[model samples]
Target: MTKAKVGIIFGGKSAEHEVSLQSAKNIVDAIDKDKYDVVLLGIDKDGKWHLNDQSSYLLNEENPKLIQLNKTNKGVAIVPGEVTDQLVNLSGSEALGQLDVVFPILHGTLGEDGSIQGMLRLANLPFVGTGVLGSAVSMDKDIAKRLLKEAGISVAKSVTLTKNKRDQINYEEVKTKLGLPMFIKPANQGSSVGVSKVRNEQEFNAGINDAFLYDHKLLIEETVIGREVECAVLGNENPIASLPGEILPQTDFYSYESKYIDEKGADLAIPADLTDELTKKVQEAAVEVFQSLNCEGLARVDFFLKDDGELVVNEVNTLPGFTRISMYPKLWDISGISYPELINKLIELAIERHQRDLQLKNAVYED
Candidate 1:
């Protein structure tokens, strides 16, 4: 079999750009060398794509493969046509080879928000992970929550604040509705980039201001006091959910520092200590939410098992973290899927979906 040319695109124009770089590095270093050839592309903070080849370290370092936006760089994109000469190097200075697949390691905003997927779709590229609709639905916390709720899934009560809606958000009214210790987060950000747990009026005011910096829309979800569990979902049509894993954060909630930078901040509970019945429920809920959101290729579904021990859906991460220590891969690794094999599986799903889509008549004509 011909080795597929895999383009690992990372470092997007999102708050999680640095995290994306670290993720891509781990994947590139760990992916099975014999099976796939790799190309690294970086999207700068300004959203320009470029070839990035620089020093990379795991979750620790901030240097996300150095990048420069120029037409001559080997930044990967779908070749516009299936002509014999498929790959088009906009940078005429050199010729870069065609890519068989794209592994998007982009986090947050432009990367996970369906913008990149839109571009990839326009270029007719087969990229790993969720497509445009799924990505868009999952990225917006408000929409995601509603969809899950409509599907009869338990979700935390949330109030979405959109632009031009400066209607008085009274402290008493909000606290009465969602209660104190509610979670405030950027509607479309991940990696805990703009998330905060507010315990009081002062904290609530400040947290909202902070979250608004990352996205125009803000979501405040009522805090669900329960064990935090995660399950990884994979594949296109009939996706499977991995065994659930519990997270015990060293601090209040899984904050950014607790997740990546802090060594002693969080611990993982694999095959989470749960009754057989509860386990089955969680796994089923994870798969249900995945399908409900139209997610393809992959997703990490989070849930809160309340003090009463009933499971409630928290959120769906279309492109969850890929770092070795990240919950998505860690949960799968413990579930019998290794890093390289997981990567391969994702690519296969992407190709399968793309091929299926190709079979559909996309053009509209009038007689």
Candidate 2:
């Protein structure tokens, strides 16, 4: 059996570019070498796509893919749906090889924010993770909450804001509505970049401005003091949920530093302690949110268990961290999936979804 060609797209024009690199490394290392004729597609901070070592421009200054990965360098991405048999170059000339699928490992913005998904959809390629709609909703905290709330899932009360709405943005309104000492995070970001805890009005304005730098929208979540829990879900239409894990942030909150930089920023408690009933409820909630977003490939559903012992949905991560030691994989690891097995499963799931999508009757004239 010929190994399927997979373009592992990584590093992007986002603040989480470094994190994306780590994720790409993990996937590149894990995918079954026997079954995958891997293609390393590196999209640097400038968003220029490169295959192999052709363009050293825009490569991670400290970390280079060429230094680590030895694979065929396929230059440029042929945007999906163009009627050309050849994959167009970044300059829109020539064709790259036919790809079985794409595995975009971007974090935040263009990667997780649905921009890349849109391209994959247009190209008619089966890529990993949620589709554009699901990606968009899940990436934005504000939108995710609205949809989750509508789906009968308990979500923290949040007030959204943008730069244009600054004047109209009532600090007092948020204070009265969601209260103070709440979380202020960029709506469409991950890795906790530009996220802060606003304890007062002065800090609230500063936090909003800080968040707006990363994204136009900001979410002020009413702090739900509880056990930080996470569950990994994979597959489409009857996806399975892995056992939940508890995140003990080694900081005031799960900030960017705690998530990656700081060595002692957090600890994980796998198969979190819970009653059988509570466990079932958490799993059900995770799957429910997955369905609500119409997610396909995978997601890491985060939750907050209130001091009252009630579970509250935090947000769904369409593309959670996968740095080998990340929670999504670790949680599933303790649940029985190995790192390589997890990657293989994701790839298999992507192929399954693509075939399923292709199977949908296209013509209105069904005999």
Candidate 3:
């Protein structure tokens, strides 16, 4: 049997670029060589795509803080409206090869906020993770919370602020609304980039400035007092949820440094200690959030499990981290799926979704 050619696209112009490289490394190492052929597609900070050599693609592979894309590979471009010749070398304009599927291990901004997914759709490529609509909605925290609230799901109380309205943002007004020790973050970023826990007027003012550096929009959320828990959802149409996991953060909150840079940033409690009934509730709520957000293939649904036994949906990560210590794969690993097996299942799901999408009529009149 012919092995499927899996194109693993990683690194981006997002703040989480290094994190993406880390994820791609894990997937490339764990993916089954017998069942699939891996292609390394690395995107630089300038948003240029390259065909990286599998052996020497990543730099500083051992250190998460210093790890980066080698950026010495031959540049490539996607060929839209053609599946047979999906990618071509930029220098010679020659077809590189065909890809059976794409695993976009990219996070934040253009990568995770539906830009790459839209491009992939135009190129008629089958990529793992959520579709465009799902990716767009899930990446924006304010939009996601509004939708979840409308769908009868509990979410954090937040006030959305844009860069244009910076002058009108009164620290006192925001404080009164969200209270002290609120969370401020960029609306469309992941890996906790540009996120801050502001407790006073000075911090609030500084946080607003910092968050807007990453995105035009930001969210000022009321800090919920609860234990942080997460659930990983898999599949399409009828998705299943893995057992919940807990995050015991050593820092003030789950900061970017703690997540990717610091080795002892947080402790992950797999199969979080919860009553069977509560576990079922978390799973049910997770699936509900997944369906409500139009997510397919996979997502990590985070929640603040209140001491009163209430589960408030935090946000949905459409392209959650797949690093060795990342919660998404770790949760599933504890739920019976190994790292390699998880990659295989994701590719299978991507192909399945692509076939299903092809069935829909694209035009009223046949060409």
Best by TM-score: 3
Model 3 lDDT tens row, 92-124: 899988999999999998887899999999999
lDDT of 1: 0.81
Range of the 10 consecutive residues with the lowest summed lDDT in candidate 3: 78-87
Ranking of predictions according to TM-score: 3, 1, 2
For model 2, the local distance difference test gives 0.81
Each candidate's TM vs. the true structure? 0.91, 0.90, 0.99
Pairwise TM-score winner, candidates 2 and 3: 3
Query: For candidate 1, lDDT tens digit of each residue in 1-367?
Result: 7898888888767877766766887798788889998876766667656665534322345433332222224543445665333344555634566778889899888888798899778767899999999999999989998988888888999888875674657778889999887888988888788898889989988988898888889988898888999999998889999999999998877887777667578998887998888888888889999999999999999999998877788888999988657889988888899988998889889899989999997669845
lDDT of 2 by residue, 311-349 (tens): 899888899988745789988898899888988888888
- lDDT of each prediction vs. the true structure? 0.81, 0.81, 0.92
Clashes of each: 0, 6, 0
Error of 1 at 235 (Å): 1.1
Backbone-clash count (model 3): 0
